[model samples]
Target: MQWVLDHLGDISSLGLQHIWLSGVPLVLGLLISIPVGWLATRTRWLRGILITGSGLLYTIPSLALFVLMPLVLGTSILSPLNVVVAMTIYTIALLVRSVVDGLTSVPEEVARSATAMGYTPARRFFGVDLPLAVPVIAAGLRVAAVSSVSMISIASLIGVSQLGDLLVDGFNRDIAGELFAGVLASILLAIAFDVLIRLAEHTLTPWRRVQQGGGT
Candidate 1:
């Protein structure tokens, strides 16, 4: 405990870097995914290709992909930027599927009544489809956020000083404290994000309350 507190400055910086690596990708993934998912729903052929192609990419071993990214891009991904790109691609894959599923889950009458009321296609999506999809889509972000945290731990191998550095340092010295501390911190972070997402889901899904009250 003293060791962690004694090096508190170093630990904080490392922790902050890990957060950046994980968070930047998550935000980027959500933004990129919304449009890609929407487009996927619009085009049947493109839907299959995008989902299958991204799914294949997601299957690649993370370390292998990270190590090879440099060779493919002609520059090493030994930087935060590289980690961002690598982490985001896999997350984007899962999120795109989630977004597509979320949109599809909207009640058909919502779309039909929306159309009958003279809402333009664009209006319906932004005002209706997107709002309705918030809960499930948020559920997807929870998954992606947690997964990205785990992935960012590996980013230390490339050079990002993070809680993962604690793991590596602890491994070399066989100091169980460092390793466990790092792992514990990571679990706390994942849980914290998850709780926040659930809160957001509840706040956004007011219809859930009415449904529970039998359409009060």
Candidate 2:
């Protein structure tokens, strides 16, 4: 505790950096993947392709992905660009399926009712479908965010500033404090992301809240 306290600045800065790197890609991923996922629903063939492709991308070893990245885009991809792209792919790969599933899971009757009410397709999607999908979608994002945080540690191997640096250095020179701080920081940061996402889910998904005695 005292050692952590003494290194508060380092912890906070490193944690914040990790958060920023993890977060931007997640947001960008959702922006792109949600639409892609939704589009996937339009065609059975495309849906299968998206699922298989994303799954394959996810299966690639992170280090190998980073290594190959430099070949495609040259030095830029090897820079911070690679970290963001690698993390974003992971984010998109995980969340796209969930977003698609959530939208598809909405009851057909409810959608028919929305259509009967003269709801525009856009209105039906935003006001009806998206609302119902929030809880499940939130779960996916939570997993992706937490996983992103955990994986950013690997970003260090690809030449990024992440908690993984501490581990690498610690292993190379046998510095226990660096390893301890890095491991501890990673755990705490992961927890913070989980809690924040759950809170967001609760706030956005009021329908999921049940009364203590079953009253509305």
Candidate 3:
């Protein structure tokens, strides 16, 4: 408690950095993956390629990718952009499949009815498909958000600051309190983001609640 109070300023700064690092990639990845995933559905041939490529990208060891990003992106080794780029790739890899699955899960009957009612492809997509797809996409976002929070700790390996720094700093100083603080902070951050995602999901999917209420 005393240690935490003493380090409160550092903890606040690092926690905010963790949020920014994780949140930015999640948003950008979802934006990019939605269109790419939609295009994959339109061009069936591209679907396998996109999924496979993203899977391959995700399989790269995180530290190795961090090391590789500077060379590929021409950023300095210590730059936060490297972490952002790597995390964004990981976020896209995970969410593209989620997007594809969500879109595919939309009922064929709904799609057909929309078309029969003179809905253009774009209008149908915006009005019907995307809305129905939100629940599944939100599920993916929740998982990605939690994963990103945890992974930001790895960025501290390369000197990108965040709550992960607490672990590094603690280990160097051999202060058990700092090490415990880091672990607890990471867990709290993950849980906080998860709750926020669930709230967003609930907001976006009022019909799910309606269905449950009707069933009850």
Candidate 4:
């Protein structure tokens, strides 16, 4: 407690950096995943290739990916971009399947109704399909958010500073309070991400609330 108080400023700064390191990749990954996911739904062959290929990316060890990012991207070893790119790849791997599932979850009747109303492919996707798919996509986003936060800690091992610094520094120095603080902070950050995603999901899907209200 005393250590946390004394280093509150440092912790706060690291927390903000942690947010940056994790948040940017999540947004980027989601943007990229949407199109790829949509493409996968367009045909059987594409679905097999894209879903399997993207899913395989997650199997790569996070540490090895982090180390390789600089070589692949030509960024400096210490550059935060390496972490951002690697994390984005991870986020996409997790989300593409969710987007695929969510889009498929749309009722066939609803799709037919949209088309029968003369909605174009683009219009139906945006206005009818994507909006309805929010719940499932948001579930994936929540998982990505929590996973990104925890994984970002690994960046500290590679010299990128964040809350993971606390863990490394604490462990090296034999400071239990600091180590506990890092663990606690990471958990709290994950919880915060989960809550925010849930709130966003609720806002985007008012129909769910309406259905629940009507049922009661």
Candidate 5:
């Protein structure tokens, strides 16, 4: 506790960096995946290929991907871009399948009704399909958010300044307090983000609550 308070400034700063590193990728990935997922649904032949390629990206070890990103992206070994790009790739890999599943989950009868009611493809997607898919997509986002938070810690190993730095510092200096602080902060952060995502999910999908209330 004393050690944590003493290094509060360091912890806070690194924690913010960790959040930023994780968050930017999640946002970018979400934006990118929505369209890719839509396209997958629109082009049935391409769905498997798109999902398979993204899944392949996830198989590369995180640390190895981080190390390899610099050479591929022409960035410096220490550049934060490496971490951000790698994290974004992971987020997309995680979310694309969710998006596809969510969109496809819209019942065929409902889709046919929507079309019969004069809803264009785009209008039907936004008005009918997307709303129904929110719960599933939000579930994926929650998982991605927490996963990103954990993965950012690994970025510290490759020179990015994040919460994991404390673990490295603590280990090098034999300061268990510092190590504990990092681990504790990380767990709390993940929980906090998870709760926030859940709240957002509930807020966005009011019908889910209504259904639950009706069931009750």
Candidate 6:
């Protein structure tokens, strides 16, 4: 506690960097995953290939991915971009299946009704399919968000500064206070991500609230 308070400024700066490292990847991953996921849903064969391939990506060891990012991306080993890109790959790997499942969760009859009402494929996807898929997609995003926050700490091993730095430094120096601070901060950040995602899910699914209200 004393150590944390003493290093408050450094801790705060690292927390912001941690947020940037994790948050940017999450946004970029979702943007990329939506189209990829949608394309997968268009064909059975492609669906099997994309979902299976992406799932395999998540199985790669995180530290190995972090080390390999510089080689793959031609970025400096110490460059924050290496972490960002690697994290984005991970985020996409985790979320693509969720996107596919969410989109497919839409009822077939509802989709046909949208088409019969003169909705074009694009319009129907964005207007009808997406809204209905929000609940499931949001559930996936919550998992991705927490995972990102926890994983970004690994970047510190390769010299990208973030909350993980405290964990490493504390362990080496035998400073229990600093180590505890790092663990506590990481947990808090994960919880914050979960809460924000839940709030966004609630906002996007107003009908859920209405249903609960009526049932009550």
- Each prediction's TM-score against the native? 0.90, 0.90, 0.96, 0.98, 0.95, 0.97
Write model 3 residue lDDT over 39-111, tens digit each, in one string: 9888999999998888688888999999999999999999999999999999998899889999999999999
Superposed model 3: Cα runs more than 4 Å off = none
Better of 2 and 5 by TM-score: 5
**How are the candidates ranked when ordered by lDDT, highest leading?**
4, 6, 3, 5, 1, 2
Q: Candidate 6 lDDT, tens digit per residue, 128-156? A: 99889999888888899999999989889
List the pairs of residues colliding in candidate 1: none
User: Could you tell me which 10 consecutive residues in candidate 4 have the lowest summed lDDT?
Assistant: 36-45
Which of 2 and 5 is ahead in lDDT?
5
| Candidate 4 residue pairs in backbone clash | none
Q: Evaluate all candidate structures by whole-model CA lDDT and list the values in order.
A: 0.83, 0.82, 0.92, 0.94, 0.91, 0.92
Candidate 5: minimum summed lDDT over ten consecutive residues — where? 196-205
Worst 10 residues of 2 by lDDT: 207-216
TM-score winner between 2 and 3, please give it: 3
Writing each residue's lDDT as its tens digit, candidate 5 over 1-216 gives 999989999999998988889889988998999999999999989999999998788888999999999999999989999999999999999999999999999999999999999999999999999888888888898899988988888887888899999888899999999999999989988888888878988898888899999999
> Which ranges of candidate 2 are over 4 A from the true structure?
76-78, 210-216
Candidate 3 clash pair list:
none
Mind giving the per-residue lDDT tens digits that candidate 4 earns over 43-117? 878998999999999999999999999999999999999999999999999999999999999999999999999
Q: Could you say which candidate leads in lDDT?
A: 4
What is the number of residue pairs that collide in model 1? 0
Q: RMSD in Å for candidate 6, one decimal? A: 0.9
| Model 3 residue 34 distance off true place after TM-score fit, in angstroms | 0.6
| 1 or 3, greater by lDDT | 3
